[model samples]
Target: MDSFPPALLAFNLLLYLFTYVAATDSLTAQDPYLKDGFSLVSSNGNFELGFFSPGLSRDRYLGIWFKNRRGPTSVWVANRNTPINDSSGVLVMNITTGNLTLYSHDSTAIVWSARLLRKIPNGVLQLLDTGNLVLRDRKDENPLNYSWQSFDYPTDTLLPGMKLGWDLRNNINRRLDAWKNPNDPSPGNLSWRMELHEYPESVMWKGSQEYFRHGPWNGVRVTSRPLGIAPILNFNFVSNEDEVYYQYSVPNKSHTVMVVMNQSNYLRIMYLWSATERQWRLYTSLPRDFCDNYALCGPYGYCDIRVTPSCKCLEGFKPRSPDSWTAGEFADGCERNKLINCGDEVGFAPLNQLKLPDTKRTWVNKSMDLEECKQKCLSNCSCMAYANTNISGSGSGCALWIGDLIDLKLIPDAGQDLYVKMLASELVKRGEVQKTDRLKPKMKISLAVIAPSLGLAILFIGLYIFKKRSTVKDDHEKIEAQDLELPLFDLSLINSATNNFSIDNKLGEGGFGPVYKLDIVFGKHRANGLGAEGQTNIFEALE
Candidate 1:
């Protein structure tokens, strides 16, 4: 041995290490090394792990993925932050120390390792059907008594049994982060995490900017997500002195499911196995539109995708930055029409058919009823709104919004109701404003029926009410245009006004289509100033 060269000796030691790691075919303590030629397959054969490359990238990585899935479906990577340069990588575990380590081919470099906290010496490493790589005591045989597991450390994808939250005892924050891009499994800036503050809630962030939020769990569902279709499975959120985390389970064990943070964007996409298609089918997707953005409509503003301008100041509110709104930017949000009187002077304005606002600033009481929630909110000057946290069992529990309401969106026919605090004076203002808007079209149609003299009177009648308020003029015009869609004019009226488009009323044609002139009169005078010989130009509708 003394005669052997130092380089040759090192080479011989590396050969022994490689040969020792590759001794076993099954994934266990006896079998330390898993090479490219073989894989560590789950008990049910739903997943496999080995050296593999994603997309067309030349780099090989140690990762775990669905056995049947295709096209970059790896859920967890042992070497995510660090990539292996070649296929010369092997996964190994020390049976004595109970440390799962992956090394480079030559056995010279340690790539990644599972440094578990509690080391139970005699343990076996096995991949379970739930896609968890665990270290179990060879004698105990109970999974719960395992020393460690890979489920606690996740990458971009969340399998059915995996969690997305925190482990308080170990002070570890479990989160789901997206991949850098389609071809790379490296961690990206976008992440979906739980903010365990005053009220725990799920938030999606791109860098520091919030992209989407799942309002506090109400024991039934995410208040931010209205259940359009009944759920097929159950979602669980557990919080105690020991731990706080979110996880989901399927009703049937036969069905396979996964939730992935999509590579192209910051949306969470849910996929399920489709036997017919032989691939993962999109079960559902989140943050579907601008309304889904975290606090997208801003403070005191509401979003409705059905309307042209999605963002609008809630009733009894005005845009804080009119210029920002004019430019189609709404992050600055809206201001209250009247300052809060505080205490009992303020009244609760029930906002129905809308997604609840942010819950980080909310205060929750599990034992209170809706009425108790109302009384509690009404008594506190800081409380801006309140709602039943859980809508089950006569809606027990209270969730009070103590600050500005953010990320409110109308959910068409269904949604959670929010009773927002408002000045008693403005409580009737919203109803009055809505009533006025509804009557405007009727008023305009009725006013259009009258002669010229009364038309100004009707327009003045419509103008004075909103003009007195501090609401911006441009916003009012836009609102009118949006809410008032039809002019309610009949074809016969146009035909009558044009005098059946006589040759005398005919006008020159333009590049778009044809143009025509018309003369119209009302009962006593011209209709809105169509005088004795007044000419009205009717142009063809341009495409």
Candidate 2:
């Protein structure tokens, strides 16, 4: 090539570098470089990637989100902290060095990059069906050799198949950080993480300080957030002696799900294109009502949304400050009506639709039975409450809380049941037997009346059908003289005639009646079944 000016030569070299990167695996790949652009698509083509500006922010950020989503929401943001000022952001993976980097107008100025511990001999960045953007070595064909993955660092949104804990061996911990605002992709002060310590529980941190806690793994849910435990959001514990990690996934393939913490620290789960509503629907949320705020009613208090006054003191417990409680200030919590003497006569209080307390100062035994858990809690004077850790089985294991029970909520269904340890003297103080008889008899009486009524209905229905069928021959003869003869089609004949009532035939009657109307013969001639005087079945006539 002919010698050129130094500046022009440098510009040409930069152009060649961009062109080469923009060409390699630039289309139909997980991470595609589109000439001057780039896209990250899931393996099953469920999602796509491009430059997105969250909300009203003009700053451009690279993100991957559902392709045909009802609402375009970025699930993962690459340059969240350092957004490009304009639409000129380019993402490319260097083929030789296996380094994936985002660029601004200046080719050498790196905007964001996946800091890899080691270089992959033949690496390629791929977006998996799980919504994880992973860097894999092509030649190795081993999943264990993944150099880096987007799952390790989550923005606000928690996608279907992302882990949320630490792998101490590899130093990878997938954690979620709230966004600065609705439109800004920058990390917010509130961070949500699965604490691998003690046991896996989702912990919310306001900076370095732990603000709220989702209690330890109860085999069903985090005790403090029983509502967060859902079928759509399947929690998983990855451990095998050496290390432990926690993650979640959406079991249904047809369902598009995501959990996002808005700027206000409200975690919301949304579903896409629900069958019942035929639109995107918000399934559930945390801090949904006032009760969700961590320990709104302080120690020894429970939040019951059903009551006019949702916050209430546990049985036999009185508010520390009666004046404050009446004025809607419950930070003083509640004091026991009678102090526990650790006597042999202590009992447990059954609380329904209540989320279990926090687990930070709690004790757990994964193998202890519910009864054993109860006994354990009773033995400890400080243990305020106890619950079965695994509700899936015969309620195996124990979770006992000794400190203040925080973030209690009233969930509709699937709320963890907590047995509050109370002194036997408290039962006498509250007049337990008097209240039990008042409430228990109504439920029993209602069931007793309902069960017999249902049985009587079934018996009456059977007798009526029997009597009618027994007199069918006599009724048929009586009607023959006055009623017209009607052709009764066989089930198979109707099925074959209408092709099993295919949807095509199910709608719109043709000018000649139904589209698949067929002629039927009785004996040797085609029969006109309509009588001169008899009426049609009113139901079919209305149809």
Candidate 1 per-residue lDDT, tens place, 42-94, comes to: 66777776778888788888878888776557888888877888878878777
> After superposition, which runs of candidate 2 have C-alpha atoms over 4 Å from their true positions?
1-36, 68-70, 92-97, 139-143, 196-199, 204-215, 222-248, 264-267, 274-280, 341-347, 429-431, 434-543
Task: For residues 32-142, write the lDDT of model 2, one tens digit per residue.
Answer: 453235455565767666677777888888887777665636788988989888777877776666677888876666888887757765566766777777777775546
Q: What lDDT would each prediction earn against the true structure?
A: 0.77, 0.70
TM-score of each: 0.72, 0.67
In candidate 1, what residue range of length 10 has the lowest lDDT sum? Answer: 534-543
Each model's backbone clash number? 1, 1
